[model samples]
Each structure stands twice: as structure tokens, then as C-alpha cells.
Target chain A: MSHIVVGIAEFKFAEPPHKLVTYGLGSCVAITCYAKEAIIGSMAHVLLPHAYSSSHDNEAPGKFADSAVAAMVQQMEIRDIGPSRLIAKIAGGADMFAGQFMGSDRCIGARNILAARKALDKFGIRLVAQDVGGTAGRTVEFATESGLLVVRTLRGEVKQL
Target chain B: MGSTPFLSREQVAAVEEIATIAAGQAGNALSRLLKIPIHIGVPEVANVKLSEVPALFGGLDAPAIGVLVPFQGDIEGNALLLFPEAGITELEEMLFGSSGQAEDDLRLSAFAEIGNILTGSLLTVLSSLSERVVVNLPPFLVQDMAGAILDAILGEVGTLSDEVTTLTFNLTGLEDASLVKSVLIPGSAGIELFLEAAGRLKTGR
Candidate 1:
């Protein structure tokens, strides 16, 4: 099986017989897109909300939520995968940085989740499922060949998103 | 033992200076990367209490240890920059741009670099201001704050015991906003440099 390691702010796509995995998600969010016709799927791990400028773009153009979504859409476009046909599944974005001593409201987890949703809506891709926003961390895996998503978190909790 | 207090004061001031520079540099770097302005601050001296950090973030079992930076002159006293559990996500976002599913060490690599940059930049500024100092060895990424400190650090350090205060700067959306400005200085280290720098700018009394 072909395995793809998606780095922070990075994204990739492949047809069947390939699997994509990203590990150690604290507050940053991860998104996976899949389509059966072309049998193509892609994933992105974003660290920030938006790309401030063209100068800020990097190898992992999908590192920011806004830009990453566009990056994924662009990848799909290149492969003739229509945006309307793709199903989106997302996971990660836990607040790994919580401390009772720092007070509340510093929790950026909720904000990350909200930002991801808002960004995805612009693309018209249906969000089929999500596992997000908590005090712990998470790891996510997506099998594009099967269109299955597995989310693992600190409580040893594993579920399909 | 007789010179412990004296040594403590000097070390405190040194750390304070480090904090001011670190705060400034970190704010600057993140601003450049995110295009959003960030501000950093440190607590003042009289308020540098070692026990306060654990008390503030401590559970019955989670006793945390902290590093202290004492302020000197316009920046007198110490301020504690405690890293909490929630802080991890913030750091992750700042470093990786998307907190994706990566191994923990890989996730922390970016933040460790940030801490390195903040600390390294602060040391560079301090070297120009007074005595030269370096925080050799990389910053250890820890899920457990107190446990990490006790395990990784050497010697003794203090904390910003009193209220935590932050200094903010408008990097964007401001007409006359200053770039290369000092954001915050705590009670620890040598904060007088901030006042000194401010006075040089005719913004101080």
C-alpha cells in the first residue's frame, strides 16, 4: 500500500491503493476530501487560519485553513474532480495547550473548528463528519481507497469521522 | 549560601532582560508570519513569587516549576510565562499553521524552534545591551509542565508571583504604529533597558 505522510501545512492526493496519515494534532486542524468516480482523495493539515500574502505561500500551501481548502480544491480541479461531488471529512484541532493557571478563553480550539467550517462552506463540499475541539490531542487517518476515516485521541477513544 | 540572595537578584535581572527581548522578537516574528499583530508581557519584580505559578496552574498533584526573569530600571521585577495545556495548541498553530495529525515530537518541533527563536533573539538583543548570555541546549517539549522543569532544568529559578500583565503593539491597522518596538517587560531580568529604549524614543518621562 502506498502511504503518504502529510506534514504541517502540507497536503497530497492519490487514487486507490494509497493511504494518507497525519499524526500528533494538538490545536491545528486536518481535512480530508474524497471522490469515487476519479477515485481520487486528498488531505491537508493546516496550522493557521489564512494566508496573509502571496509571499507567505510555502511548499505546504494548504497549511492555513483558508488557503489549504483552496489548495485542495485546486488539486481536485487539476484531476477533474468536481467540487460538488467531493465529500469532506475532518478531524483534529484539540487544545493541547490548556492550563487552568492561564485562565479561560485562551482556548483556540473552538476558533480553529469554526474557521475550518467557514472555509469549507465556501467550496460547497459537504462536510460528512468531524471530530474536533477538546482539551486533549488527536491523531487521524484516512483511507482514500475505502473512504474511511479513523480518529484516535488521548482517552484511547477511536471513532469514525 | 551567604551570597544566595545576591546571586538570585543578578540572575533574576538577567532573565528579565531575556524576557523583554524574547517578547519583542516573538511578537515580531509571528507578526511577519501571520500578518496579525501580537503582544507579549512579563510580570514585575516585587511580584516575582516562585510559588504563585504552581498555585495558579497547579492541581492537587500537578506542582509546576517555573523560570524567572527579573526586571531592572524601567523593567524591574519578574514575570512568569507559564506554559499551560491550552498553550500547547496555541504554540502548535503558531508553528505548524495547521495542527494536523503528526507525531507529538514533530508537532512540537515547530514550537521548540519558536522558543529557540524567541530566546535566541532575546539573547542577541541582550548581548548588545549588557553581558552576553546563551540558553544552550534546545527547549524540551513537555506535556507535564512541572515534571518537565524538574527533570530538564538545572540550578534554581523563580517565577512571576503576582498578576500577569501584557504589553501590546499595533503591527498592522495602525497609521503611526511602531515596528521593532518592545512589547512587554517583566519583573525579572533587566527591564530598565525597555525604559532606556523608550526614553531614547522621547516616549518616556
Candidate 2:
């Protein structure tokens, strides 16, 4: 069983016995889409809510909420998995700076979370589990075979979402 | 976002010099505040992709004590001082003459104070570029993995551009250069201002 680290602004697909992980998630959100019957999964670690390209045709689609969801859906389409068969789990979007940021800066984490949810909904993927929104950082792991997402906080707290 | 690089060589060097001066002043300020010897080392400044910031610093999963100072006025930016565990211990000893840790609240304040002084000194120097720069707000202190701590700030930067300019330097005054790291993440607009200021300063205009 190998765990591939999906870096920020990047996404990857996995098969059985393979897992995807992302570390040091503060305001950045990690979105995971799993297909149970096909036993395949994809993960994206996105930095913002919207990509610069509304067409989702940019070079780095995995970097934003709307495009990451679109990228994953488009790839899954190639693998013969329909959008309805995809269930999603999301983690991160923590306010690591607390209330220290100025103006709208305070709500960046919440905004990322909302964007991820909205994108998943748009793609008709059911969001089954989520561990998000706090004052600490998190690292997440998704097991492709088990369809299990493990969200671990910096303080050593773990939640299997 | 474009194929064109965000900053040219001259621009990076100009920012590096400006940041080095500020970092040196910060070290001096910390030395005075803590009554200890402090030194500043050469800094690495560049315009880089937003996603690569955590990996460039200590790392994503490593534990760190970070102080974030967010400033706005003519330009917006974030200054972060990251202290390793060893540096924290040395700080405690400098203040109390012992390696023993202080109360949690006091320790947090001390760290926050360190950040305040660092950011304060940085702002003092940066005032040259833009007199309107305001850092009146108190700095925020956080202890967590390095990557997690940076993403919140980087997420904000992501709104402006895919690439951001960061100035990273080591506080050599500590036992090891790696003991204390300071980074300045300037807003997209700040970079242009820095280049323009650098050009002006170079020409003595």
C-alpha cells in the first residue's frame, strides 16, 4: 500500500491499495472523490475557491475549487465513472491565522469550504464526510480501497471521515 | 499565471537587499528586546508559485512556532518569523537565565512580542518605500506544522496572483542558521513598488 502525496494545486488518481495524502492544510481545502463500484478515487488540494480560468481549461485546474471539481469530473468521465456514482469527502479550510487577518481575510477558510461544497454539488457528487474549519492546521489521508478519509490535526487529534 | 516570469533578476536582488536590511534591523531589535547577541544572514528572495511556499520553508508537516504580522496601507504583505524549538528554549533562557519554560500565556506573549518587534522593525525600514505603510495592528502568534501555518496567508495571496514574492532569511544570531527563519510575503502590487523603488534608489532619483 503506497500513499502518494498530492501537493497543493495538484491532483492525482488512485486505484485499490493506493492512498492519497495532503499535508499542512490551513485555508487550503482537500477534496476527495471516490467511486465505490469502480474502486477508484481522485484527490485535489486546492488553494482558492475559483480558478483564474472560468473555462476550467487552464494549465492548473487543480489549484482552485471550481476547476478542481471540474478536472476530477472530467477525468472520471474518461474512466467510465459517472458523476452520480462519485461520493466526495473534504478536509481542511482552517483559519490558521485566527482573527488576526484584516477585512475579508478572516473568512478565507470558510470561503474555500463553501466553494468546495458548491462545486461538488454542481457536479452531482454527494459529500459524505467533512472535517473542516478550525484554528489549527490539518493533514489528510484518503484510502482509495476503503473510501476512508483520515483527517489529523497538528495536535494529534484524528478523525476518520 | 502567464508564461512571463513574475520578477526579473534585478527585481529579485532589489527586494532581497531591502528585505536583508529589514531583517538585519529585526535581529538588532530582537537583540535589544531580549538583551542577547543577534545576527542576520544572507537572505533568499524570489517570486515563486503559491503552492511551493510551504516546501520552500521548513516543510509542511514539521512543527513550528510562527508569528504573523499582516500590514496594509500603500501596499499589503505578511511578515512571518518562524522559530524552532531550540530558538524558543534559548529565548526563554535569555529572559529568565534558565532553560525552564514560562507559563503558557507568558510564553505566548513573549513569542508574540518577538514577532511584534520583528515586524515592527521591518515596517520601520519599509517605511522608506512608502511612508503610508501601517503595521499598527498587533502580530498574531501560532504554533503548528509549518505548512499549515503558511497556507492561510498564501490562500489570501492566491487571490491576487499565481506567483508571490517571498524573502526568506536565517537569523544567524541563533546557534544554527536554521534555528530561526523569517519570511516576507509581499502582495503582487508590493513587488512592483519594490522594483520601482529599487530602480529609483539605484539611480538616486
Candidate 3:
């Protein structure tokens, strides 16, 4: 019944009876991977779609879609849960401001969503459900026991996926 | 985060001074609009890692209404006016003269206009102080988690540099005396030009 809070550009994993949660996902995507029989759950709050290289930079692998999905796969493997048995659910990737900024890439929310989907496909993980692409922010909670993904919007609307 | 400091102490002081002036002007403008006295707190200027910015306004999950405006010209950056959930109802009542109007588009538009005025006033002060032209884009509104809104704004800059120069303003004096915060994030090039201008103002060169 204990809850683990994940921050921006962060990730966590847990077993049955534990919950993983992340708050305020705007333009960023929160990916939750769980294996029901194995009682394993993993969550990542990804900030960007791709990873940038810098000599002085040491960023967390969970910060980008490509690396985050890969890292989650590795963590699940360590817990004896294979990629084929994992099911993923995602939420958040909101276009907070539309038509205000310059460039197509400025639509970071949409980009993050696409990237996460692509990464999931590359890893052969099935994305069972997602609530994304809107002008609102979302908070997500994932329970490992029953594998329920709960999403709450800023307008106080709740949906369980 | 990068170990190298982007702005020196003198530069930070200059930025703080400029922000203080802008906050004062913005406060006056807001007070006039709402017909209530408004007071501006001392401006806080600092270099913060993008990942850490959300913590300033509570946390990522904290519900808030954010009005974002981008300014371009001699100086380029984004200004954000953040209203925490606690005071949103009261503030809405004060602005629209009623409550339970959370989903009213008219009220939302009015709120955006208020953001426009306040941000414009701040930019005007900065432009006058730096002797440069700064123009603001239309202000847009977003009601969401503080972290999510900031991620959308700072995503580009986060890749270029691990940290950014952020100027924060705290305002008080509303009917409920609720605390409201405004954050200004200047682009790297903009900050460079601003520091140069500040140095010129200081040395009279």
C-alpha cells in the first residue's frame, strides 16, 4: 500500500501492494509498464523524446523516451519479467500552448508522445492504453497488484485505464 | 547541471534590479485594473536547473493556472504568471465579480488579457532600463500541473543548457492576500545582451 512518487525526468519500479505515481504531466509523458503475474511495475517520467549528448552532462536514462523505455526493459528483466510479458500504459503529453511558439518541433508534447510509442514498438512492448494529446495536464497512478492505471486531469476528471 | 556559472554576481544583481523595477510597474498596472492595492515582493533572480524549476511553485503535481507569454526583440524570453489552486476561486471572483465560473471562456479570456497587461508592463520597464525594444507575443493560458506547464515551456532550453536564468516575482494585496508568482526566463543570447547593457549602465561607458 506504500506509494512511490516519481519526479520529472525520473523513474521507479515496484512489486505487488505498492503503487507508483507521477504528477503534473504537461507535454511530458509518463510511461507505466507492468507484468501482472510477475507482480512487477515500472514507471518513468520522460521529459524529452531524444537524448542529447554533452561531455559534462550525466543525465538520468529515464529522462528521454528512447533511453527510458530501454532502461525500463532492463529493470524488468532483472526482476525476471521479460519484455514480451510486459504491458505498457501511458498518460500526459498535452499541448499546453497552441500556435504561440515557433517551429514544428515546438510541439514538444506531440513529439514526446510519438517518440514514446516508437520506442515501445522498437522494444516489442504493447501499449495497451493511453490518454494523451490535449490542452490539459494530468496526474497518473499505477497499481502493481491489480495493474490499474488511474489518470486525473486538472479539471478534476478521473479516468481509469 | 553545468558547473560553470552563466551569470556573475554583478550580472545577477543587475538582473535583480531590472526585475524589481518591472515587478513594481506590473504591480501598479494590476492594482489599477482590479481597483485594489497590490504590493510586489523583492524579486529573486537565480540560475536554476530546468529539472528543479517546478519545485519553486510547490511541486509538479500542484494544480495551477499558468499564463505564458513569449517576448522577442532586443531581448528574448518567456514570462509566466502562475496562480496556485488555493486562491484561484477567490481571484476569479475578484476578477469576474463572481465564483463558480471556472469553465467560463469569457473569464479565461479576461485572465489572459490581464496576463498580457502585466507581462507587457514588465517588458516595458525592462526595455526602458536596458534601452532596447522588447515585444511580447500573445499570452496563452494553461491550467495544469505546475511541472507539466513548465516542461512545455522549458523543453527546448533544457536541451541547450542544463540551467537557465530565472527571475521570480511575488505579489500580495489581493482580497484574500493570496501569494501569486511570476517567472521570467531569458534566452541565453538575451541574457548576454542584457548583461552588457547593465554593465554599460553601471560604468557609464
Candidate 4:
């Protein structure tokens, strides 16, 4: 049976799965990595950029982008997924409530998107596609089997990234 | 009556204060900004009884407030913002200023925007009130049976048991008492700082 993994609040997974999905990504970003030949995939639903800065370390382990990405890559490597073969795609870095948060200043969504990019770059994973940064919150689903990424925004449109 | 778990006196007080401030600000802002007559309800402070909560929705057993569930996260030590489902109707009427059947997108968009405003407003207020408070993520807007909904949310955290204290409020939008937004500070973090602020607010410190 193909494994379907759901990234919980602080749960991070890297495995050869058929699909990885997370729902109700409000101000939380989900990053997905897939390797075609190996059919291995991993996903992280990160809430904060840095674990040390935010008090979320006590509650949400996957909240920090730095740690979450590191953890995701580590998981991928453990499953024999090579970094080079992995194509990266991301979604759900929506600013959630951007207008009231003063756009970029209080914009954690943009920050998450930037941090994800930096982290992926640091790990040598190429970003193939992204649907990030908007006023709307989104739910992202990744199909590791086909390496397809789909993003659905609340009260908005669903797009393939 | 099951006593919710033990939150430090400090944690309990902080919940009341933060909920008061958040609900007040969110309601006022939604009313002023959206002209929807959003009214923040009176704050009700109580411990989060996981057992009672299961009975609240449909008998979904959830661990602590932060535990992750099928689709949501920890829920035990979380606070709640409860609004009558009918309130949605009233809110639609007020937001539209005379509405028939509101479009699905319109309804969902309105909730999303309102959730954004509420979350942002609370962050600013808390930041101003406490030096230690830090908001990591934006508040998520959701609607479900109070129990199941909260269960989904609580599924992400560790067991909350009696550690979580909640402050609930009601809002009146469009003279029909519609819309309820809850700003929950989990029992895990943000509680102690809030209590200290409340003490200062109460003692005029």
C-alpha cells in the first residue's frame, strides 16, 4: 500500500510515500520535496522561521523553518533520497491576515517563503516551482508518486505549482 | 462540574486579560473597519476540561490542547471563540448591509479577512501590553462543531488537561449579535506573561 503522510502541527516526515498533505495552512507554510526515480518525498509544515527565537519550541517542533527544513532533509537522506535528485516545490506561505499585519513588516508568510528558499538553497535542493505569498490561507497537497503539487486557497483558487 | 486543570494563577489571569484585550480589539476593529457592528462578548474564564470537551462536539477524544489530530493540532489547553451558527447569518446581513443568500466565496472571504484582522489586532495589542509576548503564526479561522473543531485544533499539542484556561466572548454585528472570535493563548506559552500584565492592569502598576 502507498503510504500517505499528514504533517501534523509539529510532525515532519521524509519517506518514499505516494502523497503528503496538510490542510488549513493559515500563516503556516508547507514545503514539499520529491525525487522522481527514487519515488521518495518529504514535507514540512513550518509555522515560524527560527525555533530559538519563538517560544514555540515548547509547543510546535515543526514551527521553525530552519529546524524543520533541516529535519526534512535529514529524513529524506535517511530514506536514501539524494539531494541532487530531489526537485523542490512549495506552497502555503500566505500572509493569512496581511492587511492588518502591515504586509511585509508583520508578514510571516513572506518570511517563511524567504526562509524556505534560503534553507533549500543551503541544502543544495533546486526549487522547481512555488506558489507563495498572498493574503489568503491555503491547503497544499503533494503527490510524491507523480511529483505533482497542488495548492488550494480558502475562498480562492486551486492552482498547480 | 469537572474543574479544568491547574493553570498557575498567573496563567489563568493572563488568559482573561489577553482574551479581553484581543476580543475587545478584534470586535471593535471589525466593527469600525468592516462596519459590521462586531461586538466582543464578556470574557468567561475556565479551565479546559478535556473530558467535557469531548462531549462538546461529537465524542471525539482528543489529548492535550496541542496534540495533532487527523486534520488539526493540539487542542486540550486551547481557548475557544464561540459564535452561534446563526450569528454567521447576522454577520452576513451586517457585512452586506442588506443581503439575501451570500455567495460561498463571499462568506468564506469575509471570514478569512475577519480572521486576519482579529489575529493581527491581537498581536499588536499583546505586543504593546507585554514585553515578552511573541506571535509566531497568524490566528487560523475555522468553523465546526465546537467540540470537533476544538478537537482538531487541540490534536496538535501535548495534553492540555487542566493546564489550559480559556476566556470566551460574544460579538454583536449588525444589531443581531453575530460573529465570535476567540484569541486563545495555549497553556504552554504566553500565559505567564499575560498574567503579569493583568496583575499590573488590575493594580494600576
Candidate 5:
């Protein structure tokens, strides 16, 4: 099976026997949405909660939580994966520099996590699992065949959701 | 989130000169601490898209140890010292002077001290060059994905602009040939002040 790497502020879709992976998610959120019947999966690595304005609309849509979820859902729909058949898993959104307390708005990891949840709720997509909100960076891999979301931490710890 | 370039060629050259001096000082400091000669590459200064910043030290997903020192006052920005995961063990061994593996906390502390000296030396040179007082906050250490560490720092920059002014330095002279990178990210306001000061110094105005 081949693995497609989704970089920061990016997203990708994959089918059975393929994996969608994103690396080093800190203060950023990685959301994986999978449809069992269609065997379709998509992942987004969102850098912030919201876009700055319409000017930034031309840039990567997956760079913001709101747009990322919307885009992912649209991509899945193109493949005949309906919302009713979709479940989501998330990883990353870590406060890598804790106690710095830049501010609530600057608490980007937590804000990204909250934004992803809100976006998912807006689409009525059920969040089945998540590994988020900590002080470490995480690499997430989502397999379309097994529908497994694997999370690997910088400290060499691994977990499956 | 604006795309305007922050620093001009002249400004970038000025910053590069300051970084070279700072890197020299930092190399000397490290050499003293480790009692081994340290060599630094020519400093590079550039203005780049925020998305492109994480690619400098490999990629966003590459495991790294980042030492961050935030500075405010006459200037506002962050100084980051990045060490790749493969280099950390060698660095720890060199710094602690032990063959056995050192503890995590100890390694972190050593890295923090290295960051402090490097950042402090840079800020001092910048202050002297601009004749302005720049204050550095306490240094902290984080070991994680390079992308994530950058994201945490970029959160603030994200609200301001889509591009960042960066100063980078490469270090060598270790037995293992481990690569170390030092990056200085100055906020918009800080870059403006720095450019203004640099321009004045150039024209003697």
C-alpha cells in the first residue's frame, strides 16, 4: 500500500489499499474522514481555526479548520460517499510550548481542535475518535482499508484509534 | 495574512551580517562549553511564505528538538535553535561528557543553555548594531515534529502576515557531523524597526 503525505495546511484523499498520512502536527489538527461502504477516506491538516478573509480564499482551502472540513466532505461526496456513511477521527493539535500563555486566541492547538469539532458538527459528521490536546507533536496515518487512524508521538509512543 | 515582503535586500544584508557575528559568538561559546572547535556556515537571511518555513530543516514531520527564546521590547520576535533527532544523542553525549545515554531533563537543559547563549549573543549584536535595547525572555525547550514546533510559533505570525522574515545558520565541527540549525523569526513590527535602524545607520541619518 502506498502512503500519501499531507503537509501542513494541506489535505488529500485515498481509496482502499492506500493510506493518508500527515506528519508533525503541533498546534495544528489532522482530521481523517472515512466512509466504510465506499472505502473512501480523506485527511486534512489544518493550520488555524479560520481564514483571514476572502483574499486568502485562493490559497490552500485546507489551511483552516472550517474550510478543510467543508472541502474534505465535498471531495468524499464526489466519490459517492454520503455524509450518513462517514465517520471521523482526529489527531494532533498539541500545545508544544505550554505555559507560554500567548493568549486564548494564541492557544492555537486547542483552538484548532475546537474549530475542527465545530466544523465536523456543522456537517453532522460523527467524531468517532481523537488523540489531541497535549504537549507533544504527533504523526497521524489513516488507512482506508482498515479504517484505522494510527498516531505516533515524537517520543516513539504509538496508538491506534 | 498579507503577502507583502517585509525586508528589503539591504535590510536582509544587514540582518545577515548581524547573524554571522552572532553565530561566531555562539560557536565560540559552544566550543568553550564543550571544549571542542565549532564551525558555522554563512548565515542566510530571507523573507519567505509561512508554509515554506518548515521545509528548511527537512520537513514539517521531521523529528526535532527546538529551543525557543522569545524577545520583546525594542524588538519582538523569536529565536529558535533546531537539532535533528539523530543529532540529539550525540549532542547530549558531547555536552555531558559521558558515553552512556543522559537523562531527558539533562539533555533538555543542555539544549536550552545552548539556545540561550546563541540567542542572547544574537540579540546583543542586534542591540548594539541598532543602538536599541532588546530584551529576551526566558528560553524553553521542546522536542517534537519540526512542523509542529514551527506551527506553535507561527500561530502568532499567522494572525499578522502570510510571510515571515527568517535568518538561518548552519553549524558543524562535531565528530558525528550532526547538523544544527538556528533560525531567527522577527515579527512585522520588529522587522520594521530593524530595517529603519539599519537604513539610518547606512545613510548616517
Candidate 6:
């Protein structure tokens, strides 16, 4: 089995016997989309609530919540996977700095989660599970074959979503 | 290539000089507070594209403890200090004269003190350069995977502009000289504000 590493603002798609992983997700959110029966999946490391940079900037679409979900869905469609066939799960979005300079409503972590949820809804992708929002960082792995999202913290805490 | 040059040669030189000042003053403050002889080698300063930010902070998956001191005034910027897990114990031992178990609040405060001193010195030097006063806000202490902690700051600044001025220095004489990482990231706007205050920029007001 091989593992595909998704870097910050990067996204990758994979098939059976392959895993998608992202590390150290502080305020950033990682979204995993999978089609269980087909055993294909993708993951994105999203950094912001929205893409403010104009299209001229040629910025990575996976860097923002709204665009990442849309881009990931476009990838799924390009490979013959329908929106209904996709199941989504998200992790990360922790307030590592603990919300001082920004208010709770304005917190980036909170805003990222909100944007992710709204995007998933927009694409009609059902969200299965999530481990989001806190003061700790998270590293997540998604197994395409098993359709399991494994979330782990630096403190040795692990959860299978 | 589309936008004009981010900074002039003189302004970049100004940034390097101010960073050198910050590194020296922060090193001295840590040495005194920790009660250990400390050394700061040549400061490493860079003006990098924002896309390279994730790689700028090394050891993404590794655990780290950090302190963030935010400053506001003529310019807004931040100073971040990071230590390896073991550096925490070395800090505790050097700080209270023993490694015996201490309350979490006490340990946090002790580390905050280190942040306060180091950040205070950097802020002071920055003020000296701009000839404009700035104030240091309360410090934020965090312990987690290095990437995760930095992502919070990165996410905030990544959208602002494409250029980032980063300055880093290491503090030797601790448990591991290389374990201590101190960085200053004055975002693009902050850089313009700095250049303007220093009379190096004449484009806008």
C-alpha cells in the first residue's frame, strides 16, 4: 500500500490500498471525500474560509473551504463519481492560539469549520463524522479501502471516524 | 512578476538590520532570564514567497511549545518563539533552579515570562527603528505539533499578500542549542508600514 501526502493548500485523490494523510492541522481544516463501494478517496488541507485572491492570482483552490470542497467534488465527477456517491468527513480547525486577538465568531478555526460545513452542504455531499474545533492540533489519515478517517493528536489521543 | 517590486534594496537592508537588532537583544534577554550563557549565531533573514511558508517552519509533525507576542502601533507584527519538548524541561530547571514538578499555570507563566522578555526586546528595537512607539500585547502560549501551531498564524497572513519577511535565530547554551527557534514575521503590510516609517518608501503617503 502506498500513502499520498497532502501538503498545506494541496489536495490529492487516491484508490484502494492507498491512504491520504495531512499533518499538523492547527487552524486549517482537512476534508476527506470517499466513495466507499468504488474504494476511491481524496483529501484536502484547507487553510481559509474563502478564497479572497482573485482568479488572476492563480491561487490553489484547495487552500480555501468553499473552493476546496468545490474542487474536490469536481475531481470526483471527473472520475465518474457522483455527488451522491461521496461521503465527507473533516478534522482539524483547532484554535491553537486560543482566541484572543480574534473573537469567537471571528476565529479562523471556527470560521473554517463553518465554511466547510456550508460547502459540503452546497455540494450535497453527506458528512459522516467530524472532529473539529478545540485548542489542539490534529493529524489525520484516510484509508481509501476501509473508508476510515483516523484522527490523532500530539498527546497520543486517537479517534476513528 | 505582475505586481511591482515588494521592497527596495534599502528597505530590505533596513529589515535585516532591525532583525539583527532583535536577535541580539532577544538572545541577551533569554540568557539573563534562564541564568545560562547563551549564544545567537548569525541571524537568518529571508524575504520569501508566501507559498513557501509551510516549509519555512521545519518539523511539521514534531511536538513543540511556542509563545506568541503581538504588537500594535505604527505597524502590526508578531514574534514567535518555539522550543522542543525537552527544551521545556531545560527551561523549567533553569528557570526555577529545579526540574521538580511545578503547577501547570506556574510553568506556563514562566514560559510566558521568557516570551514577554524576548518579545519586549524585539518590540523595543522595532520601535527604535521606526522612531514610532509600539506596545506589546499579552502573550499567547501554545504547545502542540509544530505545523498545527504555525498554521493558525499562516492562515491569517497567507491571504494578505505574497511576500513575507522572516527572521530566525537560535539560542545556544540551553539543553540543545538548536532546539530553540525564535522568529519574526512582519507581514507584507507591516513591511510597507515599516518602510514608510523609516522614510525608505515614498510611493504612498
Give the DockQ (2 decimals) of all models: 0.01, 0.67, 0.55, 0.03, 0.52, 0.60
DockQ rank order: 2, 6, 3, 5, 4, 1
Where is model 1 more than 4 Å wrong at Cα? A57-59, A99-107, B1-205
Chain A structural similarity (TM-score) per candidate? 0.88, 0.94, 0.94, 0.83, 0.96, 0.94
Share of true Cα-Cα contacts across chains kept by each model: 0.00, 0.78, 0.70, 0.00, 0.72, 0.72
What is the per-residue lDDT of model 3 for residues A22-81, given as tens digits with 9 covering 90 to 100?
988888899998897888899999888987675424677777888899999998888888
Error of 4 at A31 (Å): 0.8
lDDT of 3 by residue, B136-197 (tens): 88877876778777775567666666676777766677453854555656655457656866
Q: Compute the lDDT of residue B138 as modeled in candidate 3.
A: 84
Clashes of 4: 33
Every model's Cα RMSD, please?
18.5, 2.8, 3.3, 10.0, 3.2, 3.7
Q: Which window of ten consecutive residues has the lowest lDDT sum in model 1 chain B?
A: B151-160
Segments of candidate 5 deviating more than 4 angstroms: A80-82, B1-10, B31-36, B39-41, B47-55, B75-77, B88-94, B98-100, B160-163, B172-179, B186-193
Best by lDDT: 5
Number of clashes recorded per candidate: 52, 0, 1, 33, 0, 0
For candidate 2 chain A, the 10 contiguous residues with the lowest summed lDDT are A51-60
Residue-wise C-alpha lDDT for candidate 5, range A1-161, written one tens digit per residue: 89998877788889978899888888889998888888888999888898877877766778889999999888888877777789999888888888564465668888899999999999999999999988888888899998999999878899999
lDDT score for residue B80 of model 1: 26
Query: Quality of candidate 6's docking, in CAPRI categories?
Result: medium
Error of 4 at A95 (Å): 2.3
| lDDT, candidates in the order shown | 0.52, 0.76, 0.77, 0.55, 0.78, 0.75
Model 5 B-chain TM: 0.82
Query: How well docked is model 5, in DockQ terms?
Result: 0.52
Better of 1 and 3 by TM-score: 3
